[model samples]
Target: MSIEVGSKLQGKVTGITNFGAFVELQGGSTGLVHISEVADNYVKDINEHLTVGEEVTVKVINVGKDGKIGLSIKKAKDNPNPKSGRHKSNPKNNRNGGGDRTESFEAKMNRFLKDSEDRLASLKKQTESKRGGRGAKKG
Candidate 1:
């Protein structure tokens, strides 16, 4: 079976790396599922998500000119439950239901600046407190 782009097939996990998992599809072809395609969330470790000899349903995302096959376990699963994975309106929540729409660039910068300022002020106060205590040691 010739693997083509957008083809869905069952494959066996042949290797696992920090970045992705190697799958052996039918017809003795192999493909790589990037870390981002391993799951709907942040895949810190591909081994934790997939193991050798495990069966997975993957979609052929791309077939490079050099014959490198790109597969995605996430893309194959994304459309089945589009609304189910939608994240709720909670900024602090890290749950991976699906895609996340974060603040705009300007808004993010503003938030970052605010947090940074708070941290810097706290650090300066701590340093001053330590410096003030150092003088008491000698006196």
Candidate 2:
């Protein structure tokens, strides 16, 4: 069949790489399901979700002009509203998955900026101190 964008099709996993899995779609067309598209959550390893010779349902998210088809296994699944962005919860607890996030996105961003600035300032101070008093003792 013709592989078009937004079409769901059954494909066989022909190869697995660190970045993504190559799926052979109907009509002998091969597509790549990126590692990030393998699951709803973070997928550091594509092999953990898919393997060679495995049949999976993939959605044709994109089709490049150069014959490259981009597929998404997670998108093929029936999810009315898929969550976007990194799914990290409870920043203080340092755990993943859905958890109580008392802080809003803007609050979290501001907190991160403050922390980052503090760290950068400390680093600058340390470096300046090291270089300020030392300009080659005798050279």
The prediction achieving the highest TM-score against the true structure is 2
- lDDT per residue (tens digit) for residues 11-121 in model 2: 999999999999998899899999988988789888778889999999999999999999999899987344455554446775334553786899778877998999999
Query: Candidate 1 regions off by >4 Å?
Result: 83-139
lDDT tens digits, residue span 1-139, model 1: 7788898899999998878899999889999999888887677878888889999999999999999999999888747545333453564553334424565889767867998999999998899797884555654
Using all chains and alpha carbons, the TM-scores for the candidates as numbered come to: 0.61, 0.63
Model 2's TM-score against the true structure: 0.63
RMSD of each: 6.5, 6.4
Clashes of 1: 0
